[model samples]
Target: MRAPLLCALLLLAGLQACVQAFYLPGVAPQDFKRKDVIYLKVNKLSSIKNQLPYEYYSLPYCRPEKIVQSAENLGEVLRGDRIENSLYQIQMRVDEQCKVLCRIDALSGAQTKAFKAKIEDDYRVNMILDNLPVAMVKMRKDEKSNSLVKLYERGFPVGFTATTSGGQPEVKFFLHNHLRFTILYHKDEITDLARIVGFEVEPFSVKHTYETPWDKVSPTLNTCNPGRATFVTHDMPPQPVKEGEEVIFTYDVRFVASDIRWASRWDTYLLMIDDQIHWFSIINSVMIVLFLTGMVAMIIVRTLHRDITKYNQLESGEDAQEETGWKLVHGDVFRPPANASLLATFVGTGVQLFGMAMVTMLFALLGFLSPANRGGLMTAMLMMFVFMGLFAGYFSARLYKSFRGEEWKKTTMRTALLFPGVCFGIFFCLNILIWGQKSSGAVPFGTLFALCFLWFGISVPLVFIGSYFGYKKPAPEDPVRTNKIPRQIPDQPWYMNPVFSCLVGGVLPFGAVFIELFFILTSMWLHQFYYLFGFLTLVFIILLVTCAEITIVLCYFQLCSEDYHWWWRAYFTSGSSALYLFAYSAFYFYSKLDITKTVPMLMYFGYMSMISIGFFCLTGTMGFYACYIFVRQIYGAVKID
Candidate 1:
């Protein structure tokens, strides 16, 4: 019965690791069916660095017929599955005299008025205009394109340009200026009331340019080939009209699709992951792992065995006369440190973050949180953190009690607030800055309130409940008893000093993960796609092993030095990696990113601080627990009088 149950558990674990989320295949453009009509959906307008959502009239648009997929999950939807068609009417005609093509838009008064009002009232629109308008086009696989999958199915918006008719060509207005309106109001003499008179478009000839991927066949062709591409220059903008006036905004449209093939549209982003770079990173990490593993084996098999054997064989008279090394400090080894409450709080929070990270990665590895699902990763993390508050409170309360602390309520409250409070406060401040800039990246007031509700309403109560249960149980017993007076730590060599030891301990863990960290940063800041969770999971496991082994080895050395003050040292040794991480981020910003604006720079550092804080907690907890287990095991093995 036991064997069968164990086998079942093993089978379930194996299946979970290999599970993948399902993705529906995209339909061919020819086979795609539209629901009678299509509308040109407007997306947020962006500049080179910033983006903001705007209000515009939903113009009726045309597209090849196909069944558009509806968002089946929040992750899929957040990932940008909410493309909608518009209802604006349009007409196009060609003139024979100059061979100039024109687009005529026919919009109703009511629709036009509402659109204008939305544009004027929304500050986000003004912010967008301040930068410039870039219009995006959504493309899917064309059935005739002989590709297995769509490539570059979705991309950033292209810029629009309008030129003056004079010989010396100058841009009259950009697409950013084209959508703007200037209205005139009229006053009735009899009623002495003012009303909107009319609105008009400032006219100019328009042209648009797009950057295309290099063609595989004609790879050597110069990019300035007008003959090989369709040009829609010499087009006119809409004429100005009054408030009650009706006018058409026309665009003479011409599309020049590139020869770039897509075996799968999703593969476009993944193509940037160079195969050689990935292999190099993997091999580098493996080499670090082997070095650390060999060092740990030497300590456990050779050094530790020698120390234990020599200690056990000491005669009674010699043992009393020659008490030197770790055994001399046995009584004080379990002694609680100063500011026990603070250390306990940090440990509890670290445990919470560690648990949250592990669960999130596990879900992501199982395909429940794929990049295709959009905001799935962040959503999963937030939800997991809220639920994991129980563990945070429980561990904090338990550790505090073990330290003989009396202020259980205070410890619990601090556990619930400290790290999370700092993170949220920084986030809220940065959000205010984003809001002031009127960028679309700003979290809305409603979302902010919702986050607060999640933290206080859900997480706090769960933490309290866990704390209550934790206090009900007895505190953990120490493996060795504490002395009435703490043993004075002996002077240590310069290399074993806390600062030098922590700095050295952090190097190996950071080295193991820095290669993967570069890719992660690229995906976040460079707008590149990251879909390699399998590799990420492997790196995460390696990091854990590296952290545990390094901390254990360092703790042993400290013990041999007769330094029982390993509590804070153990935590800082692992947590110091976050400091290195921040330094690397600074290097990345200066060397890789082209950002120059004050707001973007502030935002970058603010978010990086939060990431570093979480990493510090996660690593610090691993180091502490590994040291705790090692200390207990080595002490228990010795036959103490």
Candidate 2:
């Protein structure tokens, strides 16, 4: 079991290292450049009386490809409108519910040819669907289209899931990327209040009431009935209609982008308008950073200063062990960590990792870096780990000294490198598996080499430096001399065991992230967009706090239970958050994912292991530091000579 567990952990660590190394960038451009393009949509009309009244619901959107195409066409037009540009294309699918279109379906090839010819002559730049008063507008003719610009500016992920009743139930997922609306109505009713504001002419129908500068009613009405005595409209906005029990005017729109990075890839050619939601996320992120930074700073400075001062002022060479601080149970300080030895290693590794993560986040909040920089996380983490190695070395040396063990050298060596080595090995094994599958998700060989260089060139040396400092920090000044003979600990019930308390400490932090993990998985596997960085950052903060608090509570309980060997116990108590993370990952896979094969399963587990390593390190660090502080405070206040 130990061997298998070790192999599994090493494999996971290696894969995570690669992902951190190779994942591409996911960020918007820094500069604002506007590219415009027209948006068009078509629908079949049920009836076309003398002068058909149509209302269009116009919303701003951007499509990069369309914008690029428009730019190319405009370039050609400027040279000379000699070239007839094929500006738009539409492919309609008639599903089983559409019975009337079957006659045209039988002559599909002929109808398609005829439709193409008719569109070339009559439609020109944009197409007309069936015999509707609404004519799609050509907003711009450019290669890089700023069609989804509005949605992008809003920062709303341009996708929504629609549910409908079938034999069981059916879900239609729509990603709103490109489509826009145009309305056409009679000019005579344009100024009328009933016509502009729109009132029910019939139970299922509406008449326009007002006229606006952008509204044009004549040209639109002329397109449907050419020779009829009907006025045409140029541009009209889509109007919202609501009546008792009628679906008079409703059209579904969607955007189709070639790839996820459509906006930035095309640069000048295609740009999405800023969506309102995106603006909101930016504002929210700024506020959250300010709030969290302030709170964290206050706690660290005020509470820690008071606690440290109180610890240092206690009289020595007295009955200081009777005091209420953490040092009261000095004998119980070097206990083996809870759970398995493997878990203990992870917790130890996590302490260093936490410092790295906190620093990186703070730096990001300060605007020195943004997520848009591809490989930024990997670079930051690599640098952080190198610096953290010093902490690992120092902490390990101090703890080993406090244990008064003869094998301090061995302990320091293992503490400095063993856990990181294990994680790296795990990550490498998983990468091999990914490579075998020929998945795009796999890290390339070159990236792997870079990662190795980063680890050796940066992290390894830092670990040695850190260990030296840690060894130098002085074994926490024990206030009271240890008795020549060790004190015997009283046996406690199972509930009071380090194992049980560590197990309990994993719950709250895990709870905070379970739901969020579902969306993260969708982003990784299903290729859905996830722009909830603000939520994610908040959850990250909550997870840290919850893990720290729970671990502190458990550590205090174990200390009170007379377990002096808490060096490892404190590490594992919070480190157990990894188990919760792993469990949640499994639940998300089985319950939330629509995975169908062994490859995806393997991939999921492989990636999950990487995540587990990070959480393990983060939570473990929190517990260790908390316990370390508590133990030092108690010992510092005691009387020793």
Candidate 3:
């Protein structure tokens, strides 16, 4: 017994050490000594205008002897991150001046053309050191305050066009080949241990003229001080990428001690945005929308109460039956809607997505999901969506049964396949487009298979189990019996027409959220970090309230008009907001972005379509549930014999 106990204790210690060694999905900080070699990893060449990312090697540039790729997670791959080793070198706590990286001889015509096109398209080079993205130090003046505004441009330009001093019409293109790095490290006074707290770089286009012979390893440059070899800042003429041109690449490194702590290192980088996000405007706009919705909702509830009272008091009297507006259609109101199966499928999927969003946002708001953990948000969303299948299946089954629908198998299949199928179809097409361009943004076939496995293996099974239990439960009886024959709905006024009413109903919900949508879109296409989960959660709640109230009000109007076909209209009334969302996206594309290519244009619209569809589902579900509850309460309150 003593011998076994010793062996078990030894095994447990080994396991604990192994777990600490691999603390998973997140990385810990490293302590650097005086001469530690720090590797530079090249990320994608990005542009806010084009809204598409290309691999670092897409443009012809200096290459290391043997390029090696770093392993990445699912979210990183989806986000188009391709971190790989580069030719540039660095040493921690050791300053170097004008160190030669590489010398590229005879730039090809294709390479030159590519460089020029990228410059015209406003591409920027992005490099990573110690997980910190390089940024350019730029200065701007505030228009309103009339003060100098300091800014850190996230990435430096790949190249720029410069006009000739002779005032010629032709402009020359210059490539940024030289970089100056300023690394900030925080050292513990007691132990003298240092941790990298910040990384910044200033890129310049310099044509170097060397007095010494060209050497692959060491080339003494006339541009450098040579004495100190640590304070080189040559303001030489820029080099243009041309056919058969000798382009030299060099970089300088300097280290500075900082007061920042390792834990709070990301605070400065995360809050590096130049312009304020304008939260006050967004909140005020949403409040106006809410105020309008509240008034309409109050009117609806009071009018409904008065109508119900009149109907209930005169059940024995013949004259007062026609007096109550909605009571006349009580018989036909409970009728199962057309395409009830489809409606159930859509609502079920919407419930899943809503659950996913709520959980993810709450986690983010609680600070459990930090931006420092790359890919954490995407991974969380995907995982939540998958697991939320249980709610979708249960709700779909219950709803279909409420509609008195048979063919359970058909409904189940539709619930499982419909929404996810459409989303995957769009995503796969976008991936194909990315693959055609030979970009790293494309999801690999293996990753696609893994996605399939998650869908089929995990989510599908959970959904099936929930559906089985849901179908077994008895469907709740309707408040009023559905008539055998439907009532002839009166001709509605022009304002109450289906299309006009849906369009009007959607406007309020769109008004409530469009302000927040702008920032979300900016974060998506412009590659800006958006972690204001508290505000996002609040906006979503407001959107839900808006959708529900507008839907209930419009549904009440339909019942008052003696038109009982409220099922599809209630869904579409809230869903029409998605049309406005897509339209807003189009306006944003034209007004805010400068994407000139057809492929990127298609990509922008395609992704926006997916976003719109998800929004439609979310808002529509809210409306449907609100209408369902309202109809039940109003009808159940009166004696409908």
Candidate 1, TM-score vs. the true structure?
0.71
Assess each prediction's global lDDT (C-alpha) against the native. Answer: 0.61, 0.45, 0.80
Model 3 global lDDT (CA atoms, 0 to 1): 0.80
Question: What's the ranking of the predictions by lDDT, best on top?
Answer: 3, 1, 2
- What is the RMSD of candidate 1? 14.0
Error in Å for residue 79 of model 1: 10
Who is ahead in lDDT, 1 or 3?
3
lDDT for each residue of candidate 2 in 501-598, tens digit (9 for 90 to 100) = 77876665565566666566655544233444555666677666665555555655666566666666677776787898888788877776655556
Give the true-structure RMSD of model 2: 16.7
Q: Provide TM-scores for the models.
A: 0.71, 0.51, 0.91
lDDT of 1: 0.61
Model 1 residue runs over 4 Å out of place are: 1-31, 34-40, 46-154, 157-265
What are the RMSD figures for all models against the true structure?
14.0, 16.7, 5.7
Across 22-80, the per-residue lDDT of candidate 3 in tens digits comes to: 23232578888878899888988888766678888988888877889777766777888
Stretch of 10 with least lDDT, candidate 1? 124-133
- Give the poorly placed runs of model 2, Cα more than 4 Å off: 1-348, 367-372, 405-416, 515-519, 526-538, 638-641
- Sort all candidates by TM-score, best to worst: 3, 1, 2
Which clashing pairs does model 3 show?
none
- In candidate 2, how many Å is residue 360 off? 2.3
Tens-digit lDDT track of model 1 for 1-641 = 65335434543542342232233222221111212121233333323243223222222122224524333332333222233323321111111111112222343566445344333322122111111112122235445566554222123322233466769986421221123122222434465333322222222323322234523333222211245653323243333322443232222222122232322323443555665676687788888888878988898899888777877885779556776778778898888888889988999899889878888888877766544444567666776777677788888888888888988888888988888899999988987887687555667676677678868976776677677777768987887788898778878999999999999999888898998999999877765567788788788888888888889989888998999999999999988999999999999998987667788788889889999999888888888888888888888777777
